[model samples]
Each structure stands twice: as structure tokens, then as C-alpha cells.
Target: MVAFAVEHRPEFSALRARLDEARRRATVAQRSLIPAPTLYFGARGERAVIDPREVRPNAAGQVESLGSDHRSILLAADVSLALPVFDRAQAARARADVDALTVQENLSIEARRVRAEVGAARASVAATRSSYERWRAIGGAVEEATVLARRGYESGQVGIIDSVIILERIARGRIAQNRSRAEYWRARTALGRAVGVIQ
Candidate 1:
């Protein structure tokens, strides 16, 4: 039951998720200490005027170069890497580690709480069941007395006052029995809740 509560409780699930996220953050921070290479790629176009001496007159009397247009495209690629001269991620890693530890402790505390709750609920159920059974027995005895009182009164062997008193006692006994039964059911419900079986 303790294990079931820990595994199925929403609070525990949330804590577990938080712990996982904290651990992931810690790992990322630790890895960040290792520098990674960054690659860059670029392209550019450039235009340059041809020298007057290189220009020639075309057949249509227009100035044109002997080759194609004086435009050029340049492509460049480079990779940059850091040497990790300083441990810049140390503080972040430490913070993440602390957060993970805190969450782990919280989860442990919550599990302990659930265990205690389950134990208390079980005790309550046992106590209430015992009380209910005892009350039921008392109620049965009271019912028998009521029946005898009624018979005596009908046969004129018992007075009205005594018969009235027995009837009242039976009523009170039934009330007590009903109350005990309700308490027993309530305790069972609480036990179910503590075990995470009652949502």
C-alpha cells in the first residue's frame, strides 16, 4: 500500500518529474563545460571595373570586355572552437545538483508521510469495526428485551412505564449501532484514500 501510494499519488508524480528535470539540467550544465565547435558558412558577390587598357570596342561600337561580366562569387566556410579556459558552468551545475537533491529529499518525506497515514487509517478501521460489532451485539440484546417487554405488556404482566423504558433503550441502542456502523465505513474509506485506491 505504501508503494502503491507513492507510485500513484499525483504529488509524488509531480515531484518525480521535477527531480528528473533537475537532473537533466545538471547534466546539461556539466556538458556545457566542454566547449563545442561552431561551424559558419557564407557567400558573397563582388563586382570590379575592368582596366581601360583591358576594355575593347565591340563590333557594334560599344565598350565590352573580352571575357564575361566582371562579377565574382565568393564562398567561405570556417569552424571555431573554444578551449574551455574557464569553468563558467560550474555554478549552474552546482545549482542544478542542489535542486535535484532537494526534490529527492521531498519525495522521501512524502513517502514517509504516506506510510504514516496508511498506518493510522488501518488502525482506525480496526477500531471502528470492533466498535461496530460490539454495538451490533448490544443492539441485538436490546431487541430481545424489547420483544419480551412487548409480550409482557400485552399479557398485562408488565406496566406501561416499564414497557416505555425498554422501548426507549432499544431506540438508543439502535442509534448507537447505526453510528458505529457509519464510523466503520468512514474509516474504511479513509484507509482506501490513504492507500491511493480511492482517488
Candidate 2:
């Protein structure tokens, strides 16, 4: 019954969503041990015109082709990686992963327990309700029988002792009816608690 409630209950989806979020977060945390790579890229271009006497020369005694009247462009790209040198980060990540797993497992266990409780509560409610119904059905019959016994005693057809017994039976029937009603409500309260609707 609790299993059914977990699946069909309106509030269950939100609760399950929280668990899913926790699972995703734990998975991401577990992968944090591996360092990510870096990428870089850049480009530059320019069109330039220089005076006839603005040329530059190099130690080779020739114009170093410094683009005296040139269109020039430069492009560069690189990727960098950092090696895992220290064990501390790996150890911490591993510990965090273990903790996250533990949290999830504990939640699973508690959920199973709640499901079981829900099943038990449902059964209890049904049993108590059946008892209550039986008591209610017999209550009217007991009252009618008590009335007949009283009339019979007044007419000398039944003894005073029989009337007293009949009254006692009526009282017991009322008590039983009340007890069954209380039990039914108590079972419903238990069910509500198991479903987390009540504190």
C-alpha cells in the first residue's frame, strides 16, 4: 500500500524529484576528481602603408620584411592540461562520493520502511472498519431485543433478571460499537502518519 502511495500520491513526485536531484549532484561531485583542460585562441590582422623611408632592416643587412607596406595577420591557438599531482583532491572527491552514496542508500531504506508502514496501516484500517460495521449492524437489533425484553418483563412474560441481562447486553453492544469506531479512526490516523501527512 505504501508502495502504491509512493507512486500515486500527489506529494510523492516532489519528494522523488529531490532524490533525483541529489543523485545527479552526487554523480557530478564524483567526477570532480578529474581536472578539466583549458583552451585558448586568438587572431589579429592589420593593413598598413608606410612611407618610402620607413622600412626597417635586420642584422642580415636586408629588410627584415617588417611589412613596410604590408597586410599582416597573426593567429594562435593552444590547449593546456594540468596533471593531477596532489592526492588530496582525489581523496576528498572519493570521500564525498562515498558520503553521497550513503545518503542515497539511507533514503532508500527509509522509504521502504515507510512503504511497509503504509501497508500495515491500510490493513489495520480495513480490519477496524469491518469491525465497526458489524457492530453498527447489530446495534439496532440489540436495542430492539432489549425493548422486547423490558415489555416481556412488565407483562410477566419475562423475569426482571432477564431484563437486567438484556440491558447489560445492550450496554456491551454500545461499548463495542464505540471501541470499533475509535479503532477505525486510530487506524486512519496511523495511515495518515505513515503517508507523512501528519506529524
Candidate 3:
């Protein structure tokens, strides 16, 4: 029953999910401490016109000629990484760790609560069933006495008042028995709820 409750209870399942999410966050934070490299790819095309007549004279009086028109295509690839010099995700990791621990503790507390409820429900069902059985036995005995009283009254051995009294006792016994039966069913329903068998 405890296992069923833990598996089926919505609140418990939510707590478990929270714990899992916390653990996942913690793992991500821990991995963030390592610097991840980013790859970049770029391509460029250039078309330019250079006049040959545009010559220049150097300091040594030598003539320098400008190249002709040309087209160039450049493709580059590079990888960049940011060093973890200042922030290593320490604070985030710490927070995730704390959250995971808190959720774990809460899950444990919930499990204990479920077990306690199931135990109490089982005990209640047992007690109520015993009470109902006892009442049923009393009711049976009262019914037998009522039959005897009716027979005596018919034979003129028992007075009408006495027979009426016996009938009233039978009625009271039946009422008590019915009440006990209702209590037993109620306890069973409670047990079902505790075990997560009922909504």
C-alpha cells in the first residue's frame, strides 16, 4: 500500500519530479564550469578596381605601381572560448544542490506520512470489522430471543408486554448492528483512500 501510494499519489509524484528537475539543473551547473568552445564560419567576397596609373614614389625615389582590378573570395573558420575566470557557476550549482536536498527531504517526509496513514487506516478497518462482527452476533442472539418470546406469547406462557419488550430489544440490536456495518464500510473506504486505490 505504501508503494502504491508513493507511485500513484499526485503530490508525491510532483515532489519526485521536482527532485529530478533539481538534480538535472545541478548537473547543468556543474558542466557550466567548463569553458565550451564556439565554432564560427564566415565567407566574404570582394571586387575592387585599382588604377595602374595611380603610382606612388617611395622615400628612395623608386616608383610603386598599384595592382589591377581583381576579385577575391575569403572563407574563414575559427573557434572561440570564454575563459571561466570570474564566474564558474558556483552560486548556481550551490542553489541547485540545496534545492535537490530540500526536495529529497520533503519526499522522505511525504513517504513517512503515507506509511503512517496506511497503518492507521488498516488499524481502523480491523477495529471496525471486529465491532461489526460483535454487533452482528448480538443481533443474532436478540433475534433468537424474539422468536422464543413470540412462541411463548402465542402459547399464553409469555405476556403481550413481555413479547413487545423482546421485539423492541431486537429492533435496537438490529439498529446497532446496522450502525456497526456502516462504520465498517466507512473504515474500508478510508483504507482504500490511504492506499491510493480511491480518488
Q: For this target, which candidate reaches the highest TM-score against the unseen true structure?
A: 1
List all candidate RMSDs to the true structure. Answer: 11.7, 8.9, 10.2
The C-alpha stretches of model 2 lying farther than 4 A from their native spots are: 1-92, 154-156
Clash statistics: count for each candidate? 0, 0, 0
Task: List per-prediction Cα lDDT, in the order shown.
Answer: 0.85, 0.73, 0.83
Least accurate 10 contiguous residues by lDDT in model 3: 75-84
Q: How close is candidate 2 to the true structure, as a TM-score?
A: 0.57
- For residues 1-199, write the lDDT of model 2, one tens digit per residue: 5665566554566656666766666566656755544445555556665565666787888864444465555444455555456334555556656665766676577678777889899899999999999988888898798788888988999888877988888888888889999999999999987876665
Candidate 1 has its poorest 10 consecutive residues by lDDT at 76-85
Residue ranges of candidate 1 with Cα displaced over 4 Å: 33-86, 137-148
| Pick by lDDT: 1 or 3, better one | 1
Local accuracy of candidate 3 as per-residue lDDT tens digits, 14-80: 9989999999989998887555544455555566545657778778998665665565655444555
Question: In candidate 1, what are the lDDT values of residues 21-134, reduced to their tens digit?
Answer: 999999999788466544455555566757677789988999887655565555444555553445668778889999999999999999999999999999999999999989
lDDT of the structure predicted as candidate 3: 0.83
Best lDDT among the predictions, by candidate number: 1
